[model samples]
Target: MLSIILLAVALSIDACIVAFSYSLTLNKNLIKNAFIFSFSSAFFQAFMPIVGFFIMYYFGLKFIELAKKIDHFIVFFIFLFLGIKIIKDAFKNETIQIEKNLSFKIVFSLSVATSLDALAAGVLIFSSKLDILDCIFIIFVITFVLCFMSFCIAKSIKLNIKLLQIISAIIIILIGFKILIEHTIKHI
Candidate 1:
């Protein structure tokens, strides 16, 4: 239980950061939108591990091992590419601003993007023979709480939204690089 909680908190760090970024762009009903985003992310984080555990339990350890190898690189590349794209989008002459009202599509996209790392972590948790239910619950609770906290913090702060966006992009890119380096080191 302790280990599961620890892993959940560890995995939630990225989600917290992403939630903070989203908060900056949000202008209206911040709490509502933030909760929705957080819930989706947390649920996915929790659910993915169970799914992975089932896959491993029913299939084979060999498949899980292979998945672990590619997971890191896949997540890293996706984040890196998305970060670069966000940076580019930010620089365009016609800046596309996100409205205060939350949409399913936007929330869904953000949830998927931010919680992708958790999906990768899910594979690891499954292989380690940890209790999937406990881990998933911990992850869901942790991410939800942290994301809400981040949203509140963001709402309280009086900073430039554009600057926040740039910072968010940088943070994501750094995470991607960190993941890449960690995996490369492990392989070598």
Candidate 2:
């Protein structure tokens, strides 16, 4: 249960960052933009994990017994790689420039891009004790809430994008280490 919440929070950070970015540029139709971005983000964030879960579930089923031996390693490496990637991308200092005219296509595209990590994260769910549906609900709710709050928050204050990314990366990396250590201790 704690793992699910942590993973959801970590995964949703990307969407929140994007929402915060867009919120700065948007000057009109704030409600519509927020809804579109939030819904698109939440839907993909929730759906991609199920897709990833099924992908591993179906393809890796034959190797389940073998995989159980090294699933922790798989989860660790994936989370580590993602964490490093996020940190790396954060340092690039890429400017987010979007038109004031928001479209479903634009928001949808960004949502898909931001949620890609969640898809990769889905594989880690198999290692957890919680049900997939429970994970999905948690992810959807957290992501939606965070993104909506991000837009509201962005309107009044400036947040350090790089700082947020770095913190999120550390959380993910620590979670990876936690899982790795837990499994290693059990195996010993």
Candidate 3:
């Protein structure tokens, strides 16, 4: 249970970071939109794992191992790309304008993109022999809590949003490196 909780937190970090980024711009409708954002993030975070698990579980054990190899690489690159994009935005000459577009499609896209790592993480949970339902439940709860917390905390801070975004980007990049290094070491 503890491990599952930890894993859930790990998978939710990206969602939290993304939430923090958006929170910086959200001066109005904060409460209503926070719930909406949290729900969207939690829904995808929980749903993706189930999908990844089912896809890998049916594919056979050999494929699971193969997928693990590919998963780490994919996870690393995706986070690296996202982090780079955030950093690039931070360095832009124009003031960073937060697009407060809370449209379903845009929110859904953000949720899906941020939850990509969680999809790969489903395989890890499967390989660890954890109960899928319990993991999903824990993931949903943790992600929702953390993401909302990040949103609230971000709004409270007076620091420059661009600096916070850069810090968040560094964290994302570090996570990507950590995944790559840890998995690569395991293979060795």
Candidate 4:
């Protein structure tokens, strides 16, 4: 039971981190939009595991094993692209422009990228005799709370516009690099 809670916390940390990054980039409706993004992030974080669990449950674990090989690569590219784009926007002539393009697709992309670990973990946990529904609920709540808290913390601070952009960009890029290294080492 304790281990399951720990697992939920671990998986939800991704949502927290990304929500913090999103908070840094918010120019208007900071609190409103942050919660919106955070809720969606939580939803995806919760949903990915079910998708993974069901896939393995009905189809087989072998497909998941096959997909696992390229999972990190996909996540790395997504975060790397987002990080680079944020950094490039920061360096543009305008110094930093926060576009209010908080579309559902963008939120979905971030959630998917962040929840890759959750998906894999879900498959592993579900393959055992554990209560998959319990794990799913724990994951959802943890992700929701952490994401909301992280965004609030970031939103409270009045960072310099350019500095916020740079920091957010670097944090995202570093996370991507961290994912790449962690997965590569696990593979080796």
TM-score per candidate = 0.81, 0.62, 0.70, 0.92
Report the lDDT tens digits of candidate 1 across residue range 60-131: 677666766776777687678756766775676566564576568656655765565565566777777776
Clash counts for the predictions, in order: 0, 0, 0, 0
Badly placed stretches (over 4 Å) of model 3 are: 1-7, 21-29, 102-135
lDDT of 3 by residue, 6-94 (tens): 88998898789778865665456777778899989999999988877887788856665675576667767767876787688677768
- Over 60-146, each residue of candidate 4 has an lDDT whose tens digit, in order, gives 878788777888899899888888888888888765678564667668878889988887766867777678778788888888888
lDDT against the true structure, each candidate:
0.73, 0.72, 0.78, 0.81
Residue 94's lDDT within candidate 2 is 74
Q: What local lDDT does model 3 show for residue 109?
A: 57
Cα-based lDDT at residue 132, candidate 4: 78
Weakest lDDT window of 10 consecutive positions for candidate 3: 97-106
Model 2 residue 23 CA deviation in Å: 1.3
Deviation of model 3 at 60, angstroms: 2.6
